[model samples]
Target chain A: MENPPVTDFATDWDHTDPAWVHDPYPIWDDLRQRCPVAHTDRYGGAWFPATHAGVSAVAQDTEHFTSRTVVLGNGRPLEDAPPAPIGVAPPITSDPPFHTIARRLILPAFAPGPVRALEPRVRELCRRLLDDLGDATEFDAATQYAQFIPPGVIVRMLGFPEADEDMFRDFIHVVLEGVNHPVEERIEEFAPIEAYITAQIEDHRAHPRDDLTSYLLGVEVGGQPLAPEHVFGTIILVLIAGIDTTWSAIGSALWHLASHPDDLARLREDPDLMPIAIEEFLRFYAPVTMARLVKRDVEFLGCPMREDDWVLLGFPAANRDPAVFPDADRFVIDRLENRHLAFGLGIHRCAGSNLARMEMRVALEEFLARYPHVELTDPEAVTWSQGQVRGPRRLPVRVASA
Target chain B: MKVTIDAARCQGHGRCFNLAPDVFGFDELGNGVVLVASPPDDRAERLARLAQVNCPEHAIDIEE
Candidate 1:
């Protein structure tokens, strides 16, 4: 399902384009200067908002845009997908009053208090992953280190077996990366994923544990347990949303550090800068670009969006818009006046933000503590993942001590 | 200076509490809460201001 190479992104934007996948910052910058809102006939007419203002308006104006499907694909939800308000994934895919209820049910699990409690465990996980690297002078940091952290954390939270991590990664690839697949092919791809999730639910039910899966099963909504679809949907969200998003964040941050020796040295030199540096990394290399289907025919940001049109909400691009932060393009380690929308904005802010932050901080701390020096083994060889979540898929770095 | 958080706008990004822990805190749901309504000193006020501007939702407000 290869999309033809985009001739002009301003008019015909395709996120899956090789040019966009290689480096989107420049494309976004050009679009911002030319047309803040870029329209594409691809995916049955999609709009990409390139500016902070345009993105913010669309994100907050839930009345006009629906979160029926955050990931853009050939198949429109209005055609064959689940009814709106409660889409395939709860909260992330749900809209309005239903969105609130769905979000609140899982918010406590990722609240700051509980998330902070997992810091020690996250640190230990990072340490174990780093230890696996042994004394290798050169290694693929993205595959070897960053990729493992989120899946490891998620499996523990979901009470799934650690050995099933490979399966979980495969499911994520099918969902996030397979956006261009035809509708029927997409359904076939999800068959195994659906089967896997069904089995896990049964396992959690038979042997209820104190983990999130069991908790989701036990937690009542209103007066009764959540609908089976709700339970299944939320677990799917936890797996898809929680895994690669943070993994990309970590991998991209490490990628930045590997390439920028000065930034890396400064971070390693000033241990206090890790938190602030993490924010800059998130802003500069924000991995996620959520899609929103237009609720109805409407005029938005001077663009006539038809019903079911996909609005590719570019939080990553918004973070780079000069209208928001001073020197928005520059990565400022000690940036204090940063109001970056890496986790997004409004009512639909990322639920697992606190957890993601803790994981990234711990991952970087452990990696840096183990190897004081890290540099890109070959910058040209670095490849970024396509479709929505962007980050280095193959980040080869030299960790040799000088 | 006095500070307040618009609970409606505060979706609990936690920038307020993260930047100025002494002046701000979070509720059980992790939404920002103004711990120190009126800053005790200049330094506290600066930290409060920092939190205000850093808020992604612009939920934090400062009265000078």
Candidate 2:
């Protein structure tokens, strides 16, 4: 079959098109094969690099791909963005030296030990939530399981009262649904969250505790105590980065497992395979569609990216790059040489990656162990979210009676 | 294996020592300081390698 013409790319990505929002992969695949570095003037003159190498190169080379501005059509500099740290690229968006210092202060809390310590608690939380599913044959797994777990963990880590978890979740939802609302409205929506985090930081300052909030509050950068704005910004960044990506992963894994019963059976039989399975799941369903700005004018893959040009790193596309992985679409839990960049690469890799992996592993292990017979009621009924981070919005499954 | 840490690069994040305490120790400034010049066993060696990977500053280097 002949590949479609490059001009067809424009028809594929309409921001308001609900169908495109649901499944942008087909469009992305077509663009990747035909025109890897395709431009879309639809959403304020954005460029979408659909190929594996094209996007990965941009993500890895932060010097070439700066993160100073909001890539998602928000024209404000990150520092001035109202969502505070989440919108601003402090540690993640900045270059080395400053980025290195900020990241160092926060890295210890997310090291393997702390993540491992949370494993038991994450498993228990998954079990309790799944147990409540009861005789109900159909429930949105995204809302029931995936959405609840990450925020719950975040609340605990931040020392926020557990009762306020739903509020936090709602705040994230507002921030992520940037496509539907104007940038000003989106900033307004995040105001309460910013205020709340600021208050928490002040509280932590008054009574120093062992939590992450207090740790950040006490951290000194360049021999000076970190600024309150930066502290608040980092906190916001952690909340957004930690919650959405992990939830999307859990949702994607559930969908994949429920859709493929044989894989689930194999996983259930060998519990030790859970670790590799988690890695495979990430490779297959990398939830984030990252973007980076070209720091210098560069030419690659026969396309020239000028300085300040936005290059979208299609991670889902990269994970399925045939050159990197043989039979990239197939899910091989025991697949060797799996160095997928789902958590990204280089200095700006996800800080909470260890915590994310631990959470997913524990959740999946406990879930499969508790409900081995669980199966999707209607695989076709699964709905995925639109925008940068994509995952199932609704996943309906039933636990088969043993 | 010998693990070397550059305190100037280290922000005293304590992640290196947290991952492999037997090999990588921390000073009062929270900067990672090597306690064992040579890893005692295979387990120590593996932990030492993990410390290198997890170090945000890339301050720790392991020599075999």
Model 2, backbone clash pairs (residues 3+ apart or across chains), number = 2
- Score candidate 1 by lDDT: 0.90
Displacement of the residue B59 alpha carbon in candidate 2, Å: 14
- On TM-score, the leading prediction is 1
Model 1 chain A is weakest, by summed lDDT over 10 consecutive residues, at: A77-86
Scored against the true structure, residue B61 in model 2 reaches a CA lDDT of 77
Over B1-64, each residue of candidate 2 has an lDDT whose tens digit, in order, gives 6778876565454556656789877553345789987889998888788777655456777777
lDDT of 2 at A20: 50
Maximum-DockQ candidate: 1
- Please list the residue runs of candidate 2 whose C-alpha ends up more than 4 Å from where it truly belongs after superposition: A1-7, A10-20, A74-89, A296-300, B1-64
lDDT of 2 by residue, A23-59 (tens): 6657766676777777754444457777667766666
Interface RMSD of each: 0.7, 7.2
lDDT of 1 at A342: 92
Residue A402, candidate 1: Cα error in Å is: 5.8
Give the per-residue lDDT of model 1 (tens digit) for B15-56: 788889999998877888999899898889998999998899
